[model samples]
Target: MSQQPYAPRPQDPRPRGGTPPSGAPPYPRHRPPRPPATSDLRLLLRLTVASFVLAVLGGAVGLLAAPGQLTGVPVGPAFDTFVLVGSLVLGFGVTAGLYALVYFPLREQRQWAWILGIALASMALLSTLANAALLLVGPAGASPGLVTGALKAVVDVAWLVVAVRPGVRAALR
Candidate 1:
């Protein structure tokens, strides 16, 4: 009987590059290719961070604007109290939403980020629209408000578009 010569086993760390090293066992034919790692999540990250900061600032502003003195008002005590409570509620809600929707989800790369971001953007757009309408229709001297609202609406629209892109979705996933 004749004995065959021994050959060293080949080692290939990356099998996705096609073809295993010589002398290595044949690679599995049915293995699916892995999705490539996304390399462009900077915009999303920046948006998330900015949203967080804005949420905090908004909450602070709401708290500060809670109307401590109700002087010469036509509304009753209940209405004034309601206004205070509503402002506090809205402020805290915005802060919480930003944390839950944008900050945490973005950090974890969760799909909730997309949904929450869209909701946030839509809300922002609507709020800006309302502001613009008020500025245009309200008494006089609101040009600054109109300009700010328009700018905010534009930013909101941009955020909505970027958040819904296929690349952003893939990256989040």
Candidate 2:
């Protein structure tokens, strides 16, 4: 039998001289899911400020505990100098790095912000842990009587608090 006539395709009543069916959404209409407001920013900021402050204070303590570490570059019998120098470098480096990382979200870089934040937070945690270890293992053995030592302890705890903050953890997601 003869095939039935093909039904006319429904006509799009769009205005005549109007734009053609420009392929799906000109460009992909994908909008990344936004992250829920997180408490991490506060935590991160607190940690960063605390870490920086502690680094400065720790540097001061190292200066007092082992002045020679800075004044003179020891060629021998300078274990104190070595420890002081190593600690100062580590403390400053880690703190500065974390501070920078923690600020990424303020820029609202979205996913990148969270990524860098988590990475930096982890590093900060490790750095503080290492500092605590040194304080306990070295001669001081967490018995630092100086105000700077107390400051260092306070800031280290602050860092831990930030790392565990809900906002920061959410940012990681």
Best by lDDT: 1
lDDT (0-100) at residue 41 of candidate 2?
60
Question: Which ranges of candidate 1 are over 4 A from the true structure?
Answer: 1-40, 51-93
Tens-place lDDT digits, model 2, residues 19-114 = 546563543567776565566665556666666776676666666665433444456547756776698789678667766755656335355665
User: Which lDDT tens digits does candidate 1 get at residues 18-122?
Assistant: 677688778557645534435435576666565555545544543444334455476898987787779778877756766566757665666677787778778
Candidate 2 ranges with C-alpha deviation above 4 Å:
1-40, 70-98, 106-109, 135-173
TM match of model 2 to true structure: 0.46
TM-score of each: 0.54, 0.46
lDDT of each: 0.63, 0.59
lDDT of 2 at 63: 61
Error of 1 at 85 (Å): 8.9
